[model samples]
Target: MSRSPLEKFRTIFKRSSSNSSRSNSTQSENNSLTMGGENYDYDEPPLTPLELHGYKSTTKHRLLNKELAEELRQHVPALLQISHDWELLYSIEQSGTSLQTLYDKCQPQIGESVNRRRGYLIVVQDTRKNIFGAYINEHLRPLDKKIYYGNGDCFLWKLEKGDVKDLNNKHQSIEKKEVSLNLKVFPFTSVNDFVIYSNNQFISVGSGDGKFGLWIDSNLSIGASDSVDTFGNEPLSDRKKFYILGLEIWKIC
Candidate 1:
């Protein structure tokens, strides 16, 4: 009898089983190459783990300008009134004598005050007194609240022995000198002291002696003065270099 067709077909399938397994293995290896090996392009930059919210590359303090400083000084009188009113809350008793006495003592080198209504005194004058580095009795507020009139000029006035016009004019003369000194004097400080108006233009020259070096903003326009001592030694008739450090003119904007 001829071999049954079913048995023959079964034998053929058994013989080809190993070859079919080999073909499947080869196909899987090819799939691995297609799926596991490909170059990809990055679409975004990676961020570092450590970054501050408001960090700047440069940490230098800005150079203080004369116009800005003058602008800051103009607003102090109203703030002074506000500050003086705050002080009055504590002096409600004793005819407010202690406050008056303290005010009087600081006034000779500072300024005079006249009691206005109650718990208020109008500043009659500002003496432009420098105490170590602060304007004595010159109330300083934060930078944003400082007063200014038109064209970046300041509004300073005198009350005693002056009309409205005189008061306005007196401020002009006093402002130039005071503003000049303030630009130099405002930035130096010790452990117990801190700067009020720091333009960052001047460096603390004699931190131990409360002396700082500053360059006049006009130095660039007028040229460096060849006839004066600009730092420690008082200005002399001969040419002396003013060593005002941290006073880079480029820092002015």
Candidate 2:
């Protein structure tokens, strides 16, 4: 076993201590390296005016991020409208809190609502006068003619020359359209619910031959009876046991 000389070990120990002191000095210098601090390096390149502003880099990045978020927020409504199923997408944001879980919660509604093609629900009360059904434009203004499928027959009427008098005495008549034509829901079965869509889509719901009939309103001047049948008038001959319980339309934002 070879042993180090006592003098040699003492010299090594002194060198180690010297190195430790130098390292501590370097660490202290690094600790105080901020601007205007003792260890700051003035010899380094100076920052540009924009970059010289205190916390300017960080603030600029944050502002950019906020601007991007604002832009996205502004167009979200329009984006939802462009999508095939806007309502389903809109429902996701409704719950708020935790954008991460948005997709999971919305997936089901997207599938169901899109598959059903469901939209907004307009309650056309048969008050004042029984409006078998009503149609509205993008602005939600009622069309002149209202369709009626009462007593197992289909009829059409136009809004009176002006709004009808408030018979309900609730201060306003629900909606008034002068009668145009009366046509039986021939060959189908019965009229349960009739629906109107923004794109001139009109569908009739009722219990009959296992299928529902959909008609299209070509113009406001004509009545429901005069509207062309979008779904074949005599289509689905079999008793499919189909029934139109309610009518709904989706108005995308």
Candidate 3:
């Protein structure tokens, strides 16, 4: 018999925890990991496995509902999809509209994070009513010497409202609007590794030939998206350029 989704979920997490335990001694040899010359101690704790249906967030979020979150979890890289609950790190409406505030508020304060590994999920809604964002492998922060962070596991995505054909009780064909959760994910193509670049002025992801796959301004009010060799993605917004109506970041903890 085929295993259920819950069974598969448990198996994946069980495998991850098992691997983490086997590698603990090897990983613990290095007491400190350096990011921009700043040493951060690794607590080196084992992975904490959650319950079976652990596809929920610790705090509520305006964008990316449970259904969408669960679906997105299914599509992420295997290591990132480990059983974990999300915690709202920052919100443009709640934390204010400044990009600097976003960077400041998104800094990970939880020292118990095993090996200092965490994932950030960003969701943005443009004035055109299109929703899009990225699954970042690292927190949003200013990099020294303008160096970029994150890796190929990071990706971009967009949400759209769509309809499909349906039939009513009378057997008449009709249009039924779906859940408005039509999601398109753009994974890394590995053409160029310009994954994430941030500074006091702006934050950009996936860059090549003077274009960014996603670029947000310092005010967090305006941005642009274009095809980049890094992710080989199309423009994410309805228009090439878009004004942000809402932005939020959720940390997988």
Candidate 4:
């Protein structure tokens, strides 16, 4: 019950990104192996440095505001966050809501010649407004056989409501106050290598016995969260099961 915001994320470094939604149908049946499949030119102005800290790009994210992004940034491993900018790979609002679209948009960008690979951030916000998700070492690929696919970098995290209070300012200002945005990151406990699992049926992160740290159906409309040995995370959502309100995936580029 004492998990810090983003879990003790306030004590760590800081910055951004969540999501869920009901889709009319799957966007594409054929999976594309390419990353940034098409031009994602945005017409909106770039977010201020207040949001992203150092990384700069014109792409405006749907779920990631400056506060959330900065809060989550503190929890990421230094190797991943040091000089990298988060690039949008898949978004339920910008891209289609289909789970397959997530796989396609997040296709691995590294090649055999490259020694380093980008990290994946999967952020999900449920209907109840709980923002939580996982970081993956590899791109998502739905397998035909039942098996887990990511490495040790995979972990679960969440954004929590910091103490909110009324602000007493000059001229008796009462509208704005300092709000705390905390983050909690649950790293791999090494309980099992089951860091990530994906198949045509669904995609999941963290596992122990039969419970999963986070579970999202292939439809991407609903999801569930539970404490698991892999992450030792608290139930990410208030309820055992929740409807996906928004989903977004960002890659450390």
Candidate 5:
């Protein structure tokens, strides 16, 4: 039986059952080659030692500088006020029946007292002549316990002999002195025995017979027992004897 042209073409193109499996296997191999073989993943280049070190150093330096700048900017105003207040306290003569009396005598020129106006500046002169003091921003109340913490706006400062002269000797014509102490103002929250007062506002320094103390009346509250004592672990009551040379209270307007 002779087939027609169309039938003959179909038969020649048809895949026989036996050869179908072989054809599929060959096609899979061809596809694998075209797809760039089995291992075709990309990899990132590794960093060199110099590049790694440089990146670390730059990041560290940037973080440090930022921290320092932020701290200085935040505390500049407080520092200025502290210095001004110190000058006022320094100029006053240390003569009074008691710390409270001294404070009453040296009130700064703060205008009207509308709100609960209360503030104080306390200075202690050790036998060695070193001077240090604190400024409290509120009326201090009597505490039942020997160890009392202070609150409100309170900051402590120290006047080194070297810095004091430089601070005083600056050109008188200048509105403000160019010299500034490295002294940083410590808040009440950062200290332990901030306003150690039983009957009055006072701070005890030293322990034994020579221990010294200062008394004043300013509203201030120190931190709780757990708070960080920026001064140190040695209680203020443990230090040697000292004298209260100056104490002043001002009504903050």
Candidate 6:
């Protein structure tokens, strides 16, 4: 049967509309599967670093919680009879403080004592309020040189926070779920610049940039001769930027 041109156009439009509807349905189903459920909406925002790193509950707080701090302290052993009572060395409420400034403040604490090795701990709170820290087994000295190395015991750990009640009753009041330690010295420089601790002392920590590297006595000193310490071929600026919430230098007194 010969149909009018207008009728043919109407038929084509109907077929196109049906195909479009089927395509949209298929896409919606695919999206639902990707999102983990049909009820999940794609319009919802993505998970932030804090949420992803298990800091969902305390992300809003600028200061680190006591429970979490205690948990982090557990990882640092009191080597050579050093007390667990950590003393502060330096801090910056905001960014833009030079590494040299921190070193100057730390110098007096480190002292000229060759008899007792000093251990240092640096805790930084990022903009997201996620707390991370590192430990240096030896006291950092003001150096005329731009680099120093550390022994192999240096490592970094990320504090994993979770609901204490979820674990066994033994962990009832503890919010720290786990401490993920990376023993491998982070490859920061071409030769892995770090402080070498003698007398059986060692420490390590994750940098502000989330990389593992030991604290070095390079350009950090007030009168460091070099313009910048060579961390491999990378610029000093490539190094991690941290807002020092707290710095502690503990001597084996």
Whose TM-score is higher: candidate 5's or candidate 6's?
6
Rank by TM-score (best first) = 3, 4, 6, 5, 2, 1
- Write down the lDDT that model 1 would get: 0.24
Ranked candidates (lDDT, high to low):
3, 4, 6, 5, 2, 1
Off by over 4 Å in 1: 1-73, 81-104, 107-134, 137-253
Return the TM-score for candidate 6, rounded to 2 decimals: 0.40
Candidate 3 ranges beyond 4 A from true positions: 1-61, 161-180
Clashes of each: 0, 12, 0, 27, 17, 10
lDDT of 5: 0.34
Residue pairs in steric clash, candidate 6? 149-194, 149-195, 149-196, 150-194, 150-195, 150-196, 151-196, 154-203, 155-204, 190-232
Candidates' lDDT values, in order?
0.24, 0.26, 0.71, 0.67, 0.34, 0.36
Model 5, span 97-136: residue lDDT tens: 4534443444444764535344444444333334455555
Q: Quote each prediction's TM-score.
A: 0.16, 0.18, 0.68, 0.68, 0.38, 0.40
Tens-digit lDDT track of model 6 for 1-253: 9998656544533222223344466435443322122132232233221111212332232233334444444445434223434444544432224455555555644446566655555544333222344555655544444344554444343333322222222233234555333221122233444433211122222222323233323232111011112222121112244323223333322
Best-fitting candidate, scored by TM-score: 3
Residue 140 in model 2: lDDT: 27
lDDT of 3: 0.71
For candidate 4, the TM-score is 0.68
lDDT of 6: 0.36
Q: For candidate 3, give the lDDT of residue 144.
A: 66
Q: Which ten-residue region of model 3 has the weakest summed lDDT? A: 163-172
